[model samples]
Target: MAHFSYRGRSAAGKEVKGEIEANNLDLAVEALMRQGVIPLKVSAKKQASGLNVDVSSLLNRPIALEPLVIFCRQMYSLTKAGVPLLRAIRGLSQSTTHKLLAQTLDKVHYDLTNGRNFSSALRSHPRVFSELFVSMIAVGESTGRLEEALLQLANYFEQEMETRRRIKSAMRYPIFVLSAIFIALVVLNLKVIPQFSSMFSKFGMDLPLPTKILIGMSNFFVNYWYWMIASMIAFALGMRMWIGTTTGRERWDLWRLKVPIVGDIVNRAQLSRFSRSFSLMLKAGVPLNQSIQLSAEALGNRFLENRLIGMKTAIEAGSSMTVTASNSGVFTPLVQQMIAVGEETGQIDELLLEVADFYDREVDYDLKTLTARIEPILLAIVAGMVLLLALGIFLPMWDMLDIARGA
Candidate 1:
């Protein structure tokens, strides 16, 4: 299918402008006609040209997740109210002021009109809708309950956003402390230390080791600031490239999951995501094996994905869900026990949702505790650095005073 930008009028003679996906212009018009929209003109969307289309531009693009969540909620509401799918999509698209999102929905509406499945159209833009989202939508479509699925998706994304907001809030103190340290270091090296170096030179007094080291550092920073900045930029670029590679990403993600206080939060967050996604898919009527596959792929963590894949293989071999998941070694004993119980009771989906809720609370608690603990530690480190700099400068002045007294 291809995306077509178009202008048309509805049955009420109201003009509308939007994009849609179709095999061709004729198909596009046909699709619109099914929705009671009379197409006036249609043209295929042009693909971008040149090397400028890269990861940087993609990352720099403004992503309004809140607006997306709102859109999902509103669409779910509209659909639940018995609005026709095409009309619902068009109404939602027309209501949005964001040009990119409006155009995207227009295309999606067009695709839906052309008999393409919702999940398939979503998969075409992986950057916008995630795998978990499309999978759930596919399940919803299969069950003839797309509105319910959209509501669940909106809830999931809202929870994800909250988790991110907590992490960012927790990091704020450390970031502020680090910024202060950098500014203090810059002032000491550029202004304060240089004057002391000049005074020591005129007095012809040999400085202490700490003072001498400080002076040397100050001189180097002053003379080679550009090189330092360039090297920092290069290091950041190299790190980005390295992390973009499969091996590097796996290694880094594994390391991240092993870090001290932060690792616990990360693990809990991932568990919450897995449980939530698995439960949602299952409740939406997706098959067990397919749900596991899609949930694992949605994780974005290779290590966890491999473990889930192993569980999938075991399940296909006739192993029970609880036994297969337990053998994966990634799930906690509590989770494994819950899964076993849920399977025995024939309430796996409900139990999985409970597990997800439990983990979500744990993540919130751990994040709060982590933030409280990290704040003081960061402050202490910054305080120690400042104290060291003060001593390095003031101790020399004290020695000079002692020398003058002796004379």
Candidate 2:
């Protein structure tokens, strides 16, 4: 296929110019005509230089979640109000706060003017439009329920962002405390411990075991700080490389699900996403196996995704969704019972939605209690560090005091 830029007069006598992909100029002209355009000129679009293209892309930031959510909500409102798709996109392109999104929507409007469907235009920008999103829009296009689809997408994105916000907010305190502890240890090793060691040496007294260990660690830090930094960088890179591999990531995700308080939060969040996405797909009339496959990706947990993929395979082989979910061992008994009942009553969509709501509530409660649950553990860690510092630094001082008193 070739991309052709064309100038045309629309049915409303408005002049428009845009690019379209087609086999040849004749076909491109035919496409424009089909869209009620009288083509004046058509020529192949000129490609920009590679450097210019690269620089432009580098400067184009990805759209943030809030703006995208607003875009969806606005799009639903506009479409539902009977505004034409092309006009709606053109207006949105002018009004959107995100420059990249605005530019993309402008191009989408151009594509629509050149006879492309909305979903197809969106599909061109894979970096912005996810497969699940594009697929949902495609269904909307086919079923003439584009507004409903947009509403669903808006709600899904909002919920997903809210979950992420809650998790991050809950974790902020622990992260800050851990960072402070790390900095304190570094300062002690690099400065305070050396000073104490020199003073103890002047006393000509034998240091206690804790003081000796602390001095040894201080020496190591003073002499080989470069090696320590290099080791940390290497370990980080190695972990990244390992997680890039499928098997390693699978193992890591599995381990994550076993972590105590954090794991419960992660599990509930993933299950919430799965239930919601699966419910959306089912309501949109997506097939069971396909819905499972898409929901697995949407869940954002490799371990659960693997299991859900296996469940899809099972369903394809004539197993029921309830049985497959139960056998997977990832869900709670309540979820399993709900699925079983949903299947029996053929209200799977409603039940899945309920399951999503239940998990959302669970995650909300977890977020509220997260700091409370973690505070004691953090206090214990702080206490341990303080005790170690006291023993390592102050214990030797007692001997120095005794010797000074005798002198």
Per-model CA lDDT versus the true structure: 0.81, 0.85
Residue-wise C-alpha lDDT for candidate 2, range 1-407, written one tens digit per residue: 98999865575444589999999655676688799975655766767755434565668765667887998999999999999898899899998878788888887787789887887677556457765787789899999999999999899899989999999999999999999989998999999999989988987888898898889989999999999999999999999999988898998898888898999899888999999999998898777876787688666578888888888888878899889999999889999999999999999999999999999999999999999999999899999878878998888888778877999
lDDT of 1 by residue, 309-350 (tens): 788778878899988988898888998999999999999999
In terms of lDDT, the best-performing candidate is 2
Question: Which residues of candidate 2, in runs, are more than 4 Å off?
Answer: 1-62
How many steric overlaps does candidate 2 have?
0
Name every residue pair that clashes in candidate 1. none
User: What TM value does model 2 have?
Assistant: 0.85
